[model samples]
Target: MSARSNRQIVLKSRPLGIPRAEHFEIRAAPVPALQPGQFLVQNLFLSVDPAMRGWVNAAANYSEPVGLGEVMRAFAAGRVIASRHPEYPEGALVMGMLGWQEYAVSDGQAIRRRVTETDLPLSLSLGVLGLNGVTAYFALQELGEPRPGETVAVSTAAGAVGSIAGQLARLRGCRTVGIAGGADKCALCLSEFGYDAAIDYRQPDLPDALRQSCPDGIDVYFDNTAGLISDAVLPQINRHARIIVCGTASVASWDPWPQGPRVERHLLNKAARMAGFLIWDYEHRYEEAIAHLAPLVRSGELRFREEILDGLEAAPGSIADLYEGTNLGKRLIRLADR
Candidate 1:
C-alpha cells in the first residue's frame, strides 16, 4: 500500500462571531506508518458543529481547548487503511474525534470498533448515527420528560438535535411548537418534522408569534437557541415547567457573551426547572441510544436531514453556517471523494 497522506485543517485564530477562512489553514500532512495496535485511517465523513467554537477557546468549559496550531477538533467517520492490531482489521469503518482531515492515525484504543455496512451510507454515521444523534436522544429523553397534553417548544427545530426532539415530543402526545429563523425552516418543522406549529422568529413581535403558536402554555422547552427565544417561552410556562438547555444559537456570535433575557422572575413564579446537559455525560448509554434511534430512523417514523458540503476544505465554513442558522439541518462535511 502507498504511504498515508493527509490534508488537515488547523485553527489559525479564535473566531469573533462567525468564523472566516482566515481562521483556518489547510495543510498537507504525511501520516506515520502503523505500529503495534496503531493504524491509519482514510476519513470518509467529517462532522462540523457549533460546539467547535467553544473547543477552541482557552476559557473554561467541559473539554480542553483545541491547541492553536492543532487540527481543528471534530468527530468523523473513516475507514482503516493499515492496522497492526489484531482487533482492528485493515478495512473496518469507524467513528471518533478524528478532526478536519483526509486521514487520521489511531491506536485501536484512540478509535474504537466500527460497523462496516455501507448500505446505510457512511455519511450518516457522523450525524444521526453518531454523537449528534446521541446528543439529541439523551438531552430530550433525560432532560425534557414531556408529559401528555403538555406543550413542547424547541428552537432550531429544523436542525439535527432539534428536529429529533420535536418528533420525540410528538410521540409523547404533546403539542410541539418549533421556533426557527426563516419561514422555510418553519415550514419544514411543521410539514417534514411533524411539528404542530412553527414560529418564524425573523418576524417582528417574536414573543407574540410564540404565544399564538403555543396557546396551550409551554410545558417543556427543549431550548436549542436559548436567549430571547427562551425568554419568550418563560412567561408562557405552565406550573412546574421544564427547560432542557441544549444549545444557545441565539448568542452564537463571538466577542462578549451576549446578555440573556432576565428569566429569574418567571422561574420563581412558575416553579419550573431548567437544566443544561453535556451529551457525553451519557456516553455510557450511547449504544442504547443507537439501538433505539436506529429503529425509529430506519422505519421512517423519524426524519434525518444533512446539509452535506463537498469536501474537507468546506468543513470550517460548514460549522460557520451552523452558528448562523444558515444550514437547513445537521451541518456536515464529506471527507471522502466519491
Candidate 2:
C-alpha cells in the first residue's frame, strides 16, 4: 500500500575507494502497489559482498554499476508477502537481486531460485549455499582443476569464497594453503577451513612464509585478492598450474589499472593457465552446484560463518566493514526473520 513505508539505502554517488556511509542515503518511500505479473518480497536477509565496490563504481566491471540515486544492488533471501503472479505465490521463499531495501518487487526475472531446502538456515542462501559457495564450487573444481596431492593456495582465505575453496581443495586431496589478512583469520583457515597451512599477508615476511608453507610450489592458485597477494603467488607457481581470477579485493580500481610485475615470464616457465571466472556465466548449472554443496554444508564437512548485522540500517556500513576486514566470514544484514 502507499501508506506502507519501504526503508532503502540508495547509492548517492560512485565511490572512489572503499565506500563510506556518506556515499549512500538511507530513506523511506511508500511501498508501491503491485501491478500484474509482479510479486512483493519482504526481504529477510540482505547480502553484503566485496564485489559491491565494483558494482557501485562508475568504471567498467563485470556488470553495470549501480546508477546514482538507485537502490544499491545486492543479493537477498526473502518471502513473498503479496503477488499478482501465479508462480510466485504468497509465502514462497525466493532468492534474488533484491537490492538494499526492506522489500523488493519482482516479475521473477532476477530470481535465482526458490529456497527449497529448509533444513539449513536461510541465511546460508547468501553464503556457502549461495553465490559465494557456487563461485568456489565451479571455480576450484572446473577452472582450477586441482589434482590430488597438489598444492592449492587461496587468497583472502578466511573470506566467503576463499574459505570454501580451501575446504573443497582439501576434500579433493590437495595440500591447501590459505593466505589471509591477520593471525586470527590465518588461525581460522588452519582450524576451521581445513587448510593444511595458513599465511598472513600482513606479516612482513610473507614471501618467506609462503615459500615455507608451499615449498613444492602452488599447483592451483585461487586468487581472490589480486594485488600484492597474487604478486607473491606468481613466483611460486609450479609447472602446469591453474590460476582462478575470481576477485580483486586488494586493489579498488581497475580503469587506469595499476601496474604490477609481469606474469608473462612466470606463465612461460611454468606452463600455467590463468583465467577470470564470473558466476553468471554458469547460471545454468547452479542447481548442480547447490546439489553438490548443500549436502557438504548440511553434513558439516564444509564449515562457514555468517557475520550478521542487526537491521536494514546496518547495510551502508557493511561494505566498509567487508573491505576493512572487520567481518570474519559472509557479511549479511538481518532485515526480518522468516
Candidate 3:
C-alpha cells in the first residue's frame, strides 16, 4: 500500500453463520478527493460488534446487507484531515459509519455526532459514550424500567452493554443478577460489574441455577442472548416484569429462524411485558444518554471495559472472536492515534 493510499477491509463473500477472516479481504485504494458538503477522516479506531454479523448475512435485517466488494460497514472514530463542509471543519474529531478503512469520505449524514467530550479519550466515542453505553441506558431504563427492590437479571452480564445495564440496575437499588457463559465471566459479573448474583449458562442445570439466583423472580430481564438463556429466564419472571430483548447473540443464523420454547405463555401467565430495543430508534436522545453517562464515567461511579486490537488487520477476525466470547468488553481495532 502506498503512503497516500487508503487501506480497507472489503466484504469478500457472505457468511453462512458467524463471519470469519476468510469472508473479508484487505486492499489498498487511492484516497478520493473531497466533494462539496463532504469531509475526509483519518480513522483512529474501528469498532467490532456482533451486529456486524447481521450486516453481512444474506438474510434480511433492520439494515441492508453490505454488498460484496464494498468496504465493510463499521463504526469508526477519527479526526477530520480535510473537509469541504463547514460543520465538519478540518481537525474536528468525529465518529460514525466510517467503515473498515484507514480513511473515509463522508457527506456528514453518515456522521453520527462530533466528539465533544475532550476530557475523555476519543476512543470512548465508539464504546462507553457511544452506541454501547447509550443502548444500555435506554434499553434498561426506558424499556426495563427497573425499580428499587426489584430483581433485575441481565444475560451476557459481563459484556459491554449488559455490564453497564447491570450497574445501572444496581444504582437504582435493584438486586442485579448476571448470567454469563463461563466461570471467569460469572466471576467478573460479581466482582467488577456489581451483580448481586452470577449464573454460568454453560452449566447443564441452567434453569435451576437461574431459579436459585433470582429467588424472588426477575422483575426486569435485560436479555442479550435469546435462545436457551432466554428459555431459562422467561420461566423466572415475576408479575409485571419488563423484558428487554437487546441482542440475539446465542442464535447464529436468523435465516431459518431458530425455534425455541414458546414465550407467550410465560408473558401471559406472569402478565409481563416484552419489547425489542433498537438503538437507532432512540437517536434523537443520544445526547441525553451521553450527558447522563459521561459524568458518571469521569467520576468513577460508572465503570466499563474494552479489548482493543492494535491495527486494522485485526478487523476481519474480530467479529468472530467477539461471538466466541473471547472479548471481555467492547472490542475495537486501532488504525491510528486519536
TM-score for each predicted model, relative to the true structure: 0.94, 0.98, 0.98
Kindly report which residue pairs in candidate 1 clash with one another: 16-254, 17-254
lDDT of each residue in 5-42, candidate 1, tens digit only: 67899998887665667889998878876677777778
Candidate 2, 178-264: lDDT as tens digits: 999888999999889989999989988788888999989999999998888899889999999999999988887776777899999
Please say which candidate is ahead in lDDT: 2 or 3: 3
User: How displaced is residue 321 in candidate 1, in Å?
Assistant: 1.6
Where model 3 places Cα greater than 4 Å from the true spot, the runs are 1-3
Shift in Å, residue 150, candidate 2: 0.7
Clashes of 1: 2
Cα distance off (Å), candidate 1, residue 259: 2.0
Off by over 4 Å in 2: none
lDDT of 2: 0.91
Regarding lDDT, does 1 or 3 come out ahead?
3
- Name the lDDT value of residue 71 in candidate 3: 99
Summarize candidate 3's per-residue lDDT along 226-320 as a digit string, tens digits: 99999989989999999999999999897687998999999999899999999999999999999999998999888888898998889899999
